[model samples]
Target: MESKIILITGATNGIGKAAAKELAKQGHTVIVHGRNKDKTLRVLEEIKAETGNANIDILLGDLFLLSDVKKMADDVKKKYQKLDVLINNAGGTMGKVREATDEGFEKTIVLNLLSPFLLTQSLLPLLSNAPSARIINVSSEMHKFGGKPFFHDFQLEKNYDSVRAYGLSKLYLIWISRHLSAELKPKNITVNTVHPGVSNTNFGLDADRGFFTNLVGKLLMRFSLTAEQGAASLIYLASSDDVEHVTGLYYGPKKKPAEPSDRYYSIENENRVWGYCSQIVAPYMDT
Candidate 1:
């Protein structure tokens, strides 16, 4: 495989981390991103040691903040003139109750939806500079659960459930992927979303949840995929020539096109969500 520049967010854990290791092993210039500096560096070194590939690099930022997203983009642009692929793999579910970020958006929505929107928009210049670039978004099948957004209260302001909030965030991301695929098709940049399939990782454990919810989450683990198995689809999208031209589609572990939700395929809903997110991140779209 030819070497390419690849950036993966939330690479310090789970599927993102597994993908980063696989990419690095393939001799690509892998940039691993994480929230903490120490852990980020540790993961970088660990990947280097495990893969025996010294080309791995690190970028640190809190994806929940638009300002931090812009800062991370600026750093990437300063260092590299071209980015062959961008894996928007950094996202997670919030606790039982909804919490707002400093920016006023719900924490779940900000981390999963707005962060990727701003980061991708800001990095478009670099992504466009490459001969052919791909944007792989890590989304979930649960998107169908909350595909119908409460337009009147887009942020789940009135009523908040952690699972639904998570589904809503992933749904928005899949829509953004579809919208961007169309926008960037002329530029030779393919954008796609993948459902990593319930992986056995430290996902819901970090949240402050009730005993019952936690117990259910743990029980579900028995049917979950290992982190490495979960990352197969992501690795395929990022490195497979078979999917090089594939864009604006949802993929499952089978490496085939999968349906997101009947609601998400609606043109009206796509535009509505795009317009809403664009307006919210207007100030950060200067790039």
Candidate 2:
């Protein structure tokens, strides 16, 4: 297999880090994205030493802020001409109390949905530069519990719960991935989402999501898959030849194509989500 240039957001920890290390082991040019400079550098060196592959790099950006997301994309464009695989893996559940970023968008929405949308749009040219590129958005099974959609309440101004916010963000992410897959079909840029299952990672363990929820989360961690186990689907999607032509499909942790919940799906809703994301990131699109 031809080695590819891969970028993975949230590569500092958990499944993202696991995937990065594995990819680096395969001799791919891996760009590890993280918010913390110290942590990102440490992970970059760790991957290099562990995999014995020095083709690893790092990019720093806070996905919660659109400005940072745009700047990160710019940084990538400056460094590499073509990106073969982009894994939008940086996402987490916020605190129980809804918090907004400095840019005034909800934290969960910005990190999980808007940031990936903007980053993908900004990197389209680089992705197109590759003979064929892949876009993997790390969604979750929680999307099924997103409840009903309030088209006008994307920011969750009307109603907000930490889990709901996360679920909705992942759900919307899947919708946008589908929309983008179709739009980029002619460009040979395949797009897909993945449910990494319940992974034993620092994903939501630190979130202030009340007492019982936190307890349950901790208990789940004891029985959950390891980070490496959870990242199997991601590595497969990023490197396997079987899915080279597969686009717009959701993969489960089992490393096979699976059905995403369509309880709240519709063509209209998908288009609406796409339009909303495009509008939110329009200002950063050209910059």
> Which portions of model 1 miss their true places by more than 4 Å?
none
Model 2 misses residue 123 by how many Å? 0.2
Reference-based TM-score, model 2 = 0.99
Residue 139, model 1, lDDT: 95
Q: Give the Cα error of residue 235 in candidate 2, in Å.
A: 0.4
Tell me how candidate 2 scores on lDDT: 0.95
Candidate number achieving the greatest lDDT relative to the actual structure: 2
Clashes of each: 0, 0
TM-score leader: 2
lDDT score, candidate 2, position 60? 97
